[model samples]
Target: MAGGGVAGHGASAGETKLPPLTPGPYRRRLGFVALVATFGGLLFGYDTSVINGAGGFMARPDQLDLSPLGLGVAASALVYAAVIGAFTGGRISDAWGRKRTIAVLAVMFIIGVAVVSIAPSLAVVVVGRVVLGLAVGAAAVVVPVFLAELAPYEIRGSLAGRNEMMIVTGQLVAIIMNAIIGNVWGDQYPWVWRIMFALAAIPAILLLLGVSRMPESPRWLADKGRDDEALEILESMRPPGRAKPELDDIIHTREIEKQRVSEDIGKIFHNKNLVRIILVGCGIGFFQQTTGINSILYYGSDVLEEAGFGTGGALIANIAPAAISVITALIALQMMDRVSRRKTFLVGYALVAFSHVLIGTADVVLPDGGAAKPYVLLILIVFFVGSMQLFLNIATWVTLSEIFPQKIRAFGMGLAVAVLWMTNGFLTLFFPTIIAAIGISGSFFAFAALNVIAFFFFLKNVPETKGHTLEELEEHVTDGSIFHSIGRK
Candidate 1:
């Protein structure tokens, strides 16, 4: 459970008692609201990853005449835009409130997808991707905060982590959808990409409408000293007798956050320990992308086709990894709260990094085409996706939410995710060129090297965030033991 203590100044001592928290419908209501808002995650996953399926069609040797470098940069622009969006979204969420921030992002989602759907040229498509990237970045930040604020401490990690799982699921759906449509339509209609872009608006519209009916993050309200409002919101999420303790915990959390922000960010920066927290948060994201997971996800069809599969074979093969992601995501959702975040990350990185090394070795040994060679690589990639979703991807997002202090939670998460998306953008934009130059062996080797670095980093610094409430973490943050002791107990 979340901890409690005196939070700087003094907590209010009003005569009014907090309402009781109940289970049943209250918890269900909160879960429902979280699901609705998390449509942003779905769209974020679907819209950005849709390009992966489309890439084969767009940059084919006979199609758009795109160079390897051109393919990469076009793919990368969206991620770069998302970095900017994620960074700005953090500050904007602070000022605008979580629900409102998401709404604004939904608007961006609509417009960005619209532009991409109607794009006349590759440059215009990149423009649309950039705009869509911004929305994805903002959603990545806001959705977790929304879920964390509303969920009970017992379920917070799992619920908060659900957004990421949804993101992977969305990507799987988009990839499948793209494959089905791209084959049937062929550019005779030329509107398949448009449909792909426009489909995002369906989720965006759902996000806006769902959020309109949803309450704001109670922690945000409580931080502004709106205990009554926060309690009311919490009540909507709890049973008749369960609201008060939860409210007390949330209020306790808010006060500490209020106190911490009063310190200077620059002064905090001078503290080497805090810098370590910042570095780990940023590094987690960097390593996450450098694993070349996105390269696989955003260009699965192309990668498969390059290895001697037909377009149809490539599409079918692409679905295998995506299925692995969705299945593992469902399984991981069940384990997120049960497992320690650090252990999960360690396990994930070890498997994925090793898979890359194995894939490289396979390329060297198989030399591209026995009857069994593509089949071997295909199964290996499936195992890679399984390892990624089961451990690292979910754990990385969950740990990011866990590692930062509440006061700088948004700042830390936002900056880390921005750095993540930027790294993702650069890699996505240039992967075609890189793959062309170094081939599969070289690409996997690069990923393996980075994941090796990531392994030691996590073993040394990453927190274990299995059972603690955000409030329980307050003391560690204030005392500067955030890395030393978090997630251990």
Candidate 2:
């Protein structure tokens, strides 16, 4: 039904082929946009963890002039903002379009970073951090959804995988920067952490430009009934020669759009099974945060020091978990496409739980001044981070993206992630209190218990979505089969 075709413009008379989707300039354009938006991941990592060095300056009640309560408020205000941002970001994206939503998020990142850089008071810093956190939450949820929808299901995991990889890479970069800066110039310049905070704008600006040029999701375009526009976007996705096939796929999906709800949120709520998926998503997300991963991320050095490491020892040891995370993640990226997501989640929970048990035993069994104890506990922590990256870190986000029907994909995923961030917020807010009340051993024992609970939940319920197409998944999951359980019919 395509109009401009003369039936002889390089395609056969009755080929029914999508004009050849020959490789072209469009993919590069998409990649550029995707990478730019990923800086949200960058800013997210840097804002949360880069403050490791800033804490001393921030804690100087005598010098910097702050109380413990003020510092705690400053640290946690961003999480609050993130919850608000995540809740509202999807509605804005639906109304304004993905590119515009991302552009606004970039502006927020820039403004927030700049604000944090100059804040002289705890109150001002809290305000800035909250602004930054809103940007983080929105970016965290939206970027992956945007990228996943744009990417062909063939490479969806690898493509969407980039965001998580970039996030960890950003954390690694921030940690390294903090270490180098804190070692050589942080004490002297003192405001170096501030500089780090403000520098996030560079990526923010880049993302603004990058996402602007890319096409909207063809599916999204089709959802709005812009068939011609959707086909045009789909045409650009493939080589111009393959447009017929590509457009047909898009058109086919569009024709079925009405069957899925225009109001996706309501549809998801009505489906009991989907509600379960959402709960699973929320459970995994919340458990992931409650595992105390953020505790180490936000205060690795402090945690290490409390284990009896010296001042400098804390900094060196702090990088260990981040390092462990990156290495395991590299290995994980290779495995993500190969294994079942359910199995991955189960394994992750098991390993983290075991590590906590080991750490708890070490704390209870090892004498206070025992020479071999800290090193043993450190190894256990490295193992814990490894387990987290291998299973929970990459897999949790991947599965959340998979479980929902196409109609409610955004609401389902966003709500789950919101729960994740909120749990993260509470944990970040109360980690110190927990540590004070229960002691290190007790804290770890609690995490181990949570992981045990997660293991059972995932074992009985988590579906495997490895290597399935979005269309295939939408059909398969509705049958009550989790991703891993779906047979290749």
Best by lDDT, which number?
A: 1
- lDDT by residue for model 1 over 1-489, one digit each (tens)? 223322333543222333423347776777788788889889988987888767656665554555666667667778888898888887789878898998898888989889877776778877888888888888888788778767766777778888988899899989888878877886575445667667778888888888888898887787777889888887777777666665676666565556655445676686566677788889989988987889899888878877778887888789899989999998998998787777888888899899999998998899666787788888989999899988888778877777666667778789999989988888887887788899988999889989988888888877766665666665565556656674463
> Residue 136's C-alpha lDDT in candidate 1?
88
The C-alpha stretches of model 2 lying farther than 4 A from their native spots are: 1-30, 239-247, 260-267, 478-489
The alpha-carbon deviation from the true structure for residue 214 of candidate 2, after best TM-score superposition, in angstroms, is: 3.0
Q: Which parts of model 1 are misplaced by more than 4 Å?
A: 1-22, 60-66, 187-191, 256-260, 270-272, 486-489
Model 2 C-alpha lDDT per residue in residues 396-458, reported as the tens digit of each score: 766676666666677777788889888988877787777768878999999999889888887
The stretch of ten residues in a row with the least summed lDDT in candidate 2 is 1-10
CA-lDDT, candidates in order: 0.78, 0.72
Cα lDDT for residue 105, model 1? 88
What's model 2's TM-score?
0.89
